[model samples]
Target: MAKKARVRDYDQFIVRLPPGMRDRIKDKAERAGMSMNEAIVWCLEREFPAPVTLEDRLEELATMVSMLTDSKDTYSGVVHLIAEIEETLDAIGTKGGIPADTKFSDMVRERLDYWREIELDSWRDRNESPFDDANWTSVEEPPEGDPFPNLPDDEMKKD
Candidate 1:
């Protein structure tokens, strides 16, 4: 039986390097336990990574804000934390400089508006709804009638 020929999976490209670069690449490749082509590809991938989008950053910030808001701390503490976060975001915007198409402040204001809407909805749910029973009692003791009358007394006893 004849052996099958190996297929080349990738296209070839001719790259011209400066003097001594080829030897350096060969040495580095050997040290890394990879072929020259693999080393070059790895280097290129490391140097030119995918860029982060503004949407991704906004989502990250939203997640952080949600976490801050959801903390069990006091309202004042939550407000202070949010203020610090806003200041940090402002500093980042100042450092990076605003883009021509979209301002960082505009994005922040949009997010704030969304948060305000959520808070308003929550407040309305708590205060304005007729179905909300603020005086509802906790179930520390069992009801007058046993929910599971058929269950054994031993099973119903608290530890």
Candidate 2:
């Protein structure tokens, strides 16, 4: 039986290449395990990418907007954290000052505790609105331990 011929939907074109270009195409085709025509098409596609359509541009813009919204949420969280630290330092000074030998870890732990338990209460004591409707605790809880600890996953003790 006669083998069926290959049918292509693409238009055929005849072109002349510069010296050694034909050999380069042949080498690329051999390395990639494709025909010389395929190699040429691949090279052309690589050098000239498809144009972005209106829908593509809108999708890209939408992605950027989403990223910005995430950034804003993160920024607000950080700002609230700094404010909590300031309040804690003020409370410490008024109540009994920290000992000179207090470790940085202790301060971090205290800040975290203050954020968790005492934060809302402290606001109430100071006659500040809890902003109960838009509480940070509801949005993003503070980390319990070092977020980027030096210890590896296996070395670190899990709770």
Candidate 3:
């Protein structure tokens, strides 16, 4: 006959349980598919798990903040782009969905085609003079005399 080597190598210790506690532990052990000892150890481990350091929490928070910041930055541009797309669709006389009517689809396609044609040309033909300081009129200070010199302070204060 082969010798049955003990699987558990640790020294055994006696633990006193209250009345009905043993039965409860047995039930839990059966439910968990573990022995009473294994179930007790599992429960204790779960109840008192490893302690988390402040550094670990700070790192987790930093990762979360970084992810949120990245998402915010990306979504900001997406919001503006979506708005522009909606506006474009509205201009073409259709909501941002597939049109049931073939005529409406054709109209949308035509509008898109026209826009595409003019888009680059418009960019190329942009009036650079508007951006030039030479073309801009400098703001002059208001005249020393009030334009409404005839108007009294009381009249100006009237609702």
Candidate 4:
């Protein structure tokens, strides 16, 4: 067994409360099986776990909104491309799960070629003058303080 450390006395700060609040605190303390001091400490810690600052939260929210907005425009295009690829692959029916023929292989290759051509066209368009300028935004200033809040107890132990 480990030896217990000697208890040290700390300065106590006085606080003012309404007349009946003390009684309520005593009752709550009894209900929670804690002393008034322990209850107060518990309340303070639970309400104010800190690591990330409010500025961080605000910036995080802004970043999320921006990503969500961009994803709205991009997701459908991705889904359509995936569906087209799936349909083309489905058309190339399997012999023991491997594509059976040179003809089917050629068709799949053609579909892939078409997909690559579309991607190249998109890259070219984005790289051109006006679109290229619009593609990136001015960088924002760095946050002043810690941005992430403390993880809840359960999350602290997870992989």
Per-residue lDDT of model 2, residues 1-159, tens digit only: 557666575668899989999998899899999999888888789997665433454465456556656785855665555564454344332324432233543575576667757666865777755543343344354345765345577767674
lDDT of each: 0.67, 0.61, 0.62, 0.62
Per-residue lDDT of model 4, residues 36-61, tens digit only: 98888788779875454334544654
**Across residues 45-84, which tens digit of lDDT does each residue of candidate 3 receive?**
7997655433453465456545656685755554454354
Question: Which residue pairs show backbone clashes in model 3?
Answer: none
Evaluated at residue 16, the lDDT of candidate 1 is 91
**Which of the two candidates, 1 or 2, achieves a greater lDDT against the reference?**
1
For 35-143, candidate 1 gives per-residue lDDT tens digits of 9998999988899755544555556657766786677765666566567546545554453532223366667667876987898899788778563345445445444
How much is the lDDT of residue 141 in candidate 1? 49
TM-score of each: 0.34, 0.32, 0.30, 0.27
Worst 10 residues of 4 by lDDT: 141-150
Candidate 3 segments exceeding 4 Å error: 1-14, 45-49, 69-159
Residue 131, model 4: Cα distance from true site in angstroms = 38
